[model samples]
Target: MTSYRWTMHRVYDATGNDTLGPAAISMWWLARAAAEETLQGSPLASAWLKLFRSHLSVDDPYWFRWAEDLAQSAELRRAYSGLYGRFVARALLSAHLGINRFVSLKRNGVVIPGSVAVTRISKGDIPDWIAWDDRASRHVLCEAKGSLTSRDFLAPGVPKCVKEGKAQFDRVETTGASGKLYPARWVAATRWVTDHRGGTPATLLWDPPQDHRPFSEDEAARHREAMTRAWLDSIAPGLGWRDADELLAPDRSRMAIVVNAEPGPVPPSQDWPELPDNDLPLIARLTEVARLDRFVAQRRPVPSDGPQDVADLAGAQSGSQTYQASWLPRPRGPEAKPHQGDYIAALATPFGLRPMRTRADFDLLRRAQDRARDLEEPAMIIGLPVGMDPGAAPAQTTWLDGAGISRKQDLAVFDLRRVKVDLLDSGPTG
Candidate 1:
């Protein structure tokens, strides 16, 4: 079998150029090309790759060469022997770094141990890198980069560096001949690491933007150093010569994404007992999705998965305003005071409810009261205005008399200042 070795060369350089390190960019192309091969026949992956292309420097001719090389390699008849080890290493880095939280762990705390004899996804598993069993509780899946001086992992936001320094990568570098310094070329390039076992792909995103705020250049360098070593250490445990059967050639047609990579739209109506109370918000969301789906269906297929894509479509639809104004009746009601003007206007508007003033004004409050009483629960009203003479004096309670519905005496009133009342039937107009 012929061997293909890809060495990182300085393709582009400028003291001020912060685009990507040459090694990083080249590695990115290789990893991306390999990642794309996983779904060669998939139209979905093709479309996604098209979207992915926009993120790259479109004018770069090397990218085209990289793509061509990947396509041609897919047709190779012999086993990819020499490049096998690099590919597996690439996959492990991709699996861990791609997650929101990125970290790697050691097995039995080894220092520069020889590559294990294992090859293939089964031995490596998916999301190839994971922390030691004890470390899982200490950190999240997200990865953060920072430098450590002595015992302290240094960064600005933190008051003090991690004192315990139990992180695994620390020991390996100190004992190994390579030491802690990450190969300059390895740290410079971006790679699309894949978890063949788990089938998830994430960019081994460790590079800072060259101008990271909050972090000094020295700090950023240290952070990158730590992350690079962590990634290298992750694949070290299972490293071995690649087996022809283990490597998967990129498939242009078949789309490959992480398991449950996309989420479905939430259902509108939930199952309820006997009579169901409508969930207006859920219904509104469902209705919007339906409307947008109908529109997109006519133009192109709406992916059953890809929740974010669906949301983007819905957001675009919602951003546009649709006015539906109707004729309003002439003002023939009683004149409103200065304060009442705002209240009156709000009532006239759509989706507006008038404020309850007098106890009798709580007529429509029956539903709320019924709900509260049925559950034998008390309710409190919030943000009510303070009115005049609220603590003046108590008024005699009165109501409709026998023959006709007429007030007999001042309605029962108490000082609202002293006690914090849980329930208020109604209150006077401010």
Candidate 2:
């Protein structure tokens, strides 16, 4: 039992808020490894480590403010909030600051920076991050993506970072039982999820140019079935559980990843902190045990409880975009100008409808009616409801103005008579 504790904590207290616990600290290191390996020990990762330590070291506002602003930006929503959120944020800053020619600008500002500028500090509703190339009049937007497991990676398509991050490791499988080939993966590199418990082995991925966008789920799926089959073929090969167990024994030379020591793909570096000596042996043992169990699951016909979809847990459990989209209203079509558009519609939940409670509602309907009057082919607002009789009028009138942005008056009386309305999604277009 080598007591392998993180050695860098000696330089700075990275014990975390005491809430992260050993499990969290272990995952944090894995996240660091994921980034560093993908970047080949880039100074960016080194900087991220310093910033990350600040997050754990203290609650002081000075050290955390910038990080907090980046995390809260709407544009970095996916990259900043997920398990790999913090890591990606640091990477983005690294990328942005690396640019020598840049401007600090806000969202939708008409002025494009000098043609020589390499980066733009854009704020507001646009993409949270933009790397503009004024000379080319084109730019790449870097959106950081994070996932807890193979499923999340599968769910939203593999992000370029996640792919690169996961690809840094090798999970080799035996081509044949007697052959020295066996599948091994740096499983730790991909499962940096902070929000949920279970994680899947990241599907091995690659980006030769390192300038690719996030890959879709379909793209990843294209390789999954075939790869999964091949992996099973290499390790299981119809061998009984007992025989397969023997094949995966600890002394086997094929498995390169050991828990306590630097596993295959994870290079030992002075730049990075070390895992505790005691933790290494234990990590190694567990990794081996998991390796054996997973190997058997594939060799044997029984399922491996089929990893629960992280998304499923997300819906029943709540964490950022990790929840289910249940019972949501259908999106209303974009508002069209009253002059060119023909139909206006409103959704009237029996109780959600109420008479214009204030002045704003009344003005909205009046303006809409005025706009409708000017149109060549007059459009009527239709009120739709559930279980309503044909030709039945709505109790209250609710419709956006002709501009389609404002909610107008209580035309309850007109809704019952002149307005051709029904409690259905069918608007004029419908």
Candidate 3:
């Protein structure tokens, strides 16, 4: 396995007082973003994935030579750096701030027709992406910039990018369903010092304080619905779906399968064990039983119909629409069972069986499902492998001020690593 690391520096206000924080990036998420966000259904998706993997610090020597060859060309280096920068920025924002749903302003009308309201403002100098913060009930505007220059040269250019990003943020405005303008948070994320051999990869986040604005419940609902649809649009083509409409078809149900595996060779289909019987029913009805608030919190696509039985799959008549399928990879080694693989599947209607490793995995899915059904809130299930002590929470960093008194903030620094991937290789089948 090849491990990659980076530091996240959060700048406070325009003065740029940097505080280090803990952030993580998943290789699976990056691959998905490369296909859906960067290429956006272009024919170059596979080629881009191959190039991206080569840029990483892989175990293979050939990939290192390939990266060196690409870096020799200034134009290719810049293009690779810029595209990868946006990918890292998106992953960081999602992991640190829970800003998962992103809409590209450049494809505003095509992706989500008439969703954003930018009438009075000119289209020039707009931010790259507009995302909704479900936790804070507000909108966020971000401009992403990347550079492959040395640290000394990159430092001087960051402030210039920040100034330009802030200008772009000022030009866009969006109102919610209540006809009230949602509070906006502006961020300029720049990926500087990208060469790992010379220095660690880092992202300088410039977030400036803005005027306080009120947000209404109606507006939150509107944004969540629109953004959920937008998220589907972004992921559908990459998953081999015809379009977002097919996943969101009112007559059919949808399922999102999250598979957790150790970092190594891809496991075979027969290695997938059967799911526990007790947990099967809840997994089938996750979306149908989902509370409005919980659904809004997750912002995933929903199905219009009610729950059905998994047994019906056996005798179902031909030409009947049943369920849709897609999967996500969460490659991590469980402490207890290091070699085993697990699955967490979410469905809008009843679906057939699949394999999961342990009872704890089922319990985690149950809690998440119950939260959607009863608590009306989203669950955080992206911690380390289950059935093992997670240890103490990450320690908060502290520093002394000029007055000699110490001040502390919630910040945890950590590393992110993953195994290499071959995009052309076939994944496990049913």
Candidate 4:
């Protein structure tokens, strides 16, 4: 756009070499340095960067600095004018700023936390590069792709978000040069490429009209202007300082339902003197009485043959009072077993669980669960419910509640054929 005393031809004419056109090579090297410099934090540092003498090797002398002038010469500019501007923008952006982030643009206090590139430009993919950044909040999703111009933005699989975009490059770190990093922003693409990552149809860049008609040029300018506005709005929220946690509050609230799976403990009878209006208690009492009556009738003691025999029979069931209720009938069918529900097992820690049972006891029991061999340890009592069918074997259960106080749920029948093990005696109670 501006005249310069040192032109492309002057640089290329100084050397007689050809191939790897000087302009193309210059732009390539400039782009690489620009990208690295931007990453290091200063976009303008490239202005002072000098090419190494070795760069004049057979790789093509016409490619660097000199070739750049040829590509932009009045003779060539009319034929490839669009490419000239795009190439300049790409070099400037790469030199001073990174992709996917607007820091290249010199906006203050903006950072894309997890951005990473997954593709490159040379694969005929058009987007010189692509990057991804996740949404900090459910309401906001941000990602960006950049190219030399709108035409270079499209790739067969590229998505719509980056089809054609503009970028303001900023300083970033790099491993090259003297390792001196500073803040420098650079001007880059005005067109975007796509939104999607992975798979085909990822992005499409707008193409400049081949005819270069006046109307097409005007339309292209208008579209480019609209895209800039959209880019500003898309990245505006990220630039402002706001609490991401506040935006995430609703997600936290919805999780409370997971804890409500179990009803809380029945409060102390004294604290709740008046019973709940529900008739559940009445039904429970009647059920218990009927069960006790049936058990007594079915388990009539045989007439004793003598005092010695009676004493031996009594010994058949040996245990302290704490384990009296551990022997209960198990359920019928193949499914008969003790199931430790999540809430039921978790209750032992808060309430004083049982006599001689300290917090240490619960910890030991939990560890034992992991090792199959440790399951039969003496501290836990194993028994089956009284009514459990003989065909349906009862489960070996460990009592967590304080020493078998005959709670209603505790006596629920597992099956009829269980060998009751008394917790106190550490022996069978039949």
Model 1 residue 79 CA deviation (Å) reads 33
lDDT per residue, candidate 1, 1-430, as tens digits? Answer: 0001111111111121111111112222233323222212211222222223332222222221121122136433112211322233332233212211123223333222221111121222112122211111111111212211111111111112111111212223221122232211111122221112111111112211121123344443334333333432332221110221111123210111101011111122111011124432332243243232122111235566632112111111211011011111121121121111001000000111323332333343344435544653322111111221111211222111110011111011111111122223223222
Each model's lDDT: 0.21, 0.24, 0.39, 0.22
Ordered by TM-score, highest first, the candidates read 3, 2, 1, 4
Which run of 10 residues does model 2 get worst, by summed lDDT? 8-17
Give the per-residue lDDT of model 2 (tens digit) for 295-386.
Answer: 11111243457521111111121121111112101222222323111111221111122222123433444454455555422222221111
Better of 1 and 2 by TM-score: 2
What would the per-residue lDDT of candidate 3 be over residues 116-169, giving only the tens digit for each residue?
453226556677777766656556676677765534212322356677777776
Best by lDDT: 3
Model 3 stretches with alpha carbons more than 4 Å out: 1-4, 13-17, 21-24, 42-45, 58-70, 107-115, 118-120, 150-158, 177-183, 186-197, 250-430
* Superposed Cα deviation of residue 424, candidate 2 (Å): 70
lDDT of the structure predicted as candidate 3: 0.39
Report the alpha-carbon TM-score of model 4 versus the true structure.
0.15
Q: Which segments of model 4 are wrong by more than 4 Å? A: 1-89, 92-221, 234-238, 241-430
lDDT of 4 by residue, 1-430 (tens): 0000011110000011110000111222233333222222242322221222111122222112222222236655333333333434443332211122222222222232222112121212122222211111000111223322233221222223333322211112211122222221112322311112111111111211111112244333332333223332332222221222321233322111001111112223211122236632442343232221111111234345421111111112212111111111221112123232111111111111221123443334344333323333212221112222211211233221112211111111111011121222122222
Runs of candidate 2 with Cα error greater than 4 angstroms are 1-87, 92-111, 116-127, 132-140, 148-191, 194-272, 278-430
Q: What lDDT score goes with residue 104 in model 2?
A: 19
**Evaluation by lDDT, superior candidate among 1 and 4:** 4
On a 0 to 1 TM-score scale, where does candidate 3 land against the true structure? 0.53
Query: Where does candidate 3 have its weakest 10-residue lDDT segment?
Result: 400-409
**lDDT score of residue 144 within candidate 2:** 34
